[model samples]
Target: MRVTADLDLCQGHQMCQVEAPAVFGTDPDTDQVVVLDEHPDPALRPQVDAAVKYCPAMALAVTD
Candidate 1:
């Protein structure tokens, strides 16, 4: 699966980082959500899903 974040929609709430720090991070320069892993290991799907769900901006997208 592939994961991506829309910077335009993102407000740096950091919920994704909280939910799945392995796959998401904050850009210190911009305070925006960054996708650490575009394509993640299958085992990480659940956490990735949680991050997506918890994102208030709904800026994260998962493509399988």
Candidate 2:
């Protein structure tokens, strides 16, 4: 799977960070969503999907 975040669409809600710290985080300098791992472990897919779904600004995307 592949994950991506549209920085312009992020609202610094941090839900992604809270849901998948290993795969997503907040960029201190920009206050934008930062994708830590585009291709995370399969075990982490669910958490990543949760993060994507929880993003208030709908900034996160996940694809095969």
What C-alpha RMSD separates each model from the true structure? Answer: 0.5, 0.6
- TM-score of every candidate relative to the true structure: 0.97, 0.96
Task: Name the weakest run of 10 consecutive residues (lDDT summed) in model 2.
Answer: 25-34
Query: Model 1 Cα displacement at 23 (Å)?
Result: 0.4
Candidate 2 lDDT over 1-64, as tens digits, reads 9999988889899999999999998889989888989999999989999998888999999999
In lDDT terms, which candidate is top?
1
lDDT of 1 by residue, 1-64 (tens): 9999999999989999998999999999999999998998999999999999999999999999
In candidate 1 the C-alpha lDDT for residue 61 amounts to 92
Which residue window of length 10 is worst by lDDT in model 1?
A: 33-42
TM-score of 2: 0.96
Global CA lDDT computed for model 1 = 0.95
- Candidate-wise lDDT, in order: 0.95, 0.93
